[model samples]
Target: MNKKIGLWDLVFMNVSALFGIRWIAKSTASSFGLGLGAIPAWFIFAFIFFVPASLICAELASTYPRDGGLYEWVKEAYGEKSGFMVSWLNWTSKLFWYSSFLTFLMVNVAYVLGKPELAGNKIFVLVCSLVIFWVLSAISTKGMSFAKIFTNIGALGSTVPTILLIAMAFIAVIAFGYKPASTYTVSTLMPKLNMDSLVAISAVMFGLSGAETTANFVTEMDKPEVTFPKAIMISAALVAGLYVLGSIAITMIVPTDQITASEGVLVALDQVAVALGIGHWFIRIVAFGIALSVFGAIILYIASPIKMLFGSVKKGVFSDSFTKVNDHNIPVKAVYLQAIIVSAILLITTLLPSVDAIYNVLVTMTALTALFPYVLLFKSYIKLRKTRPNEKRPYEMSKNNGKAIAIANMVLIVCIIGIVCSAAPVMPSLGENIWYEVQMIGGGLIVIFAGLLIWKRFTKRTGFKESS
Candidate 1:
């Protein structure tokens, strides 16, 4: 409806969603392997996971090019039940993921205030998390013109700080003669296919991910078929490059054990500044940038999928009143409704053992729930190829070569493995508190399956039977 999302708009939107170099901190901190050992997982997952997923999303969005891009794509292939299921998982994933990023923002704020330990302060975290979520959520209520500003901020905010950090790391290496803690050899860079390696690879699903979701805004794009695929590849390449380079930068300074999963990037930046003989002020500056970048990311997650889900309302499945847009053409009801849901999740998270536990649990559950929807996306790609043989695909993978479907199936397997591995704890540090993993896997499923009843009730209320 709103064509404000041009090519560059989609580009930065991808930047906001996919190019979170903060994930370098998250990935290197995860089971992705120790330090530089994690680098190989990037390439491995990129080929087997990200590349296929990106192709799938690009073609889906290009062919469908509708208001609810991914939802419409899946529905065309498998019907409404299938479509709503994946959309709901994606929406829920963001719901939990938002709280985690808010926690990231709160902790980074604590670092700026020179009380890095305040990240553990429950009241501070709760209040800051709620305040930040609501404020950004409210700003997002204004629709695309306003949302674009934050996304532009997201592009600049995320990239600039990461570039600076990489530069500092290179300076640390050359000027200070700081040798990196890990060395790169075939043994270290070559991936091991054990269970730990499997779990670690899933981190890529979380990091250097979400380029596919740009399809959510396909309808808003000026020339979506042409723009969407190009933006996905370009943004993903830049995002991936920054991720590996940033990983090298951070690992050059902090040892594997020193890198905490949550706020390791901030800590690494601080250590790098000290090592470089720069004042601590650089840490504060970058911390501010981290806060902005995380907020930029949070805004994109909150705005898009909720709008995608609002298509359910337009279909007469949700109350028509729920689809009300503001003067800015933004879905006002969905924006506030998602804020309410995120608040409830943050409230539920308080029951966890500690602040760190809360952050870890929410993030783990977020990552876990995100995969099911991804698996659905891959399947939708295969199904669409069969169901719509002549669907004017702007970005079709030449299936005549016979290699495309094989690669796509590999992507499907990668998604399934991530979901299976998600059932177990990805982080060993949390093994002492095994309940966190239980809550993550158990809790995430309850939310997803519950969507079935909701979808059923909506269809029933409308007296609308989905076509078989």
Candidate 2:
């Protein structure tokens, strides 16, 4: 093994990928009726979904240890058709997520420019999103070297501003005597078993996801079997803690009613600055930092998923041109294809009522589609443990197969429940709108169905067989 990446390197990479400050905003917004109960909701999902999913990923990575993450594991357990479905879902989910996330970036950029109202203007949003997405897409084709620089800057952007937000929130509440917008009592902290709360809890899964992205670097680790497990546990704890604390910080400052999913972080930061007797300059600075982080994250989403999809599948999965890479080792054709699809999504979202509405629908769709793969993932883990009992696993999720399978099933159940709840409306304006409901449930089905059609067509052309 080259052993280039150590435990800390893996830990930080996981943290950067898993922790997005924008998620704090989205989570707090989703916690609409739950109030402070959203904090415990984070812990609940972290245990049932995030933590177990990480362990399953760790075991899968160690056992397979090749480049493909979800695709390979699902393929070995099911077949190439299942594998392509996972990859297709994984890739397509990011397109919706990119719209939601990039719109968030533009929302913050509006704050930075002192034009907060522009965040809601569809034309302004559309123009800025297209420009930023294409510019980054062009840079991504240059090579990974350029993208790595932005990635490091983005990691800092996500971390530093989050720490500052959490600290400032407490300081405003304690030292400055600014009363928290919501009360956090024992009763208030208990998550309700209602539709709204379940919707919010499902959104938490989005915040804690991407832990498996770390598995791609398995080859660079020293004693990856031992190191991967330890790193995932530590990073999982850190990511979960930050999400809970950050969500609390946001709710503490911004009143629940005023919080917008896309702009809640900016709102909370503004409240913090006002309460601390600081200038709006502080808000602008942090907004700018968050925008940079969003930029870096956008680049990663654009390139990594397309790259992984191409890397995991055979040549016939897509046309030959789509599989070809340029001299810089960039999948130019695939990247361009993703950019076009995402652009179409962005354009179609103009029909949405507001910036918040656009974000809510896209994110709801993202959560529902994104979590479905975990169903297949958990199934893969259990099936592999039984069918390939003697197979080498660098870091098994559990020594006892019964215990491991149980844990996987538990995670699988949580995913199913979360996916169901995610179909509910996240914003009040959309609560009564039948179209919004259709968009949520209907959009997810369309994505999944499209993937199936493509997979069947490709598999037939390739003459792929289960045993092969």
lDDT on C-alpha atoms for all candidate structures = 0.72, 0.80
Off by over 4 Å in 2: 1-4, 30-34, 216-226, 425-432
In model 1, the clashing pairs are none
lDDT of 2: 0.80
TM-score (all chains, Cα) for each model: 0.86, 0.93
Q: Model 1 over residues 130-226: C-alpha lDDT tens digits?
A: 9888988888887656445665676777788889889988998898887776666787665555544455555567775674666656556666557
Candidate 1: deviation at residue 292, Å?
A: 1.8
Give residue 165's lDDT in candidate 2 (0 to 100).
Answer: 86
Candidate 1's C-alpha lDDT? 0.72
Model 1 regions lying over 4 Å from their true place: 1-16, 30-34, 138-144, 190-197, 214-236, 299-301, 312-314, 325-336, 390-392, 426-434
| Residue 412 of model 1, lDDT score | 84
> What's model 2's lDDT at 153?
82
Cα deviation of 187, candidate 2, in Å: 1.8
Per-residue lDDT of model 2, residues 227-253, tens digit only: 887888888788878878987898899
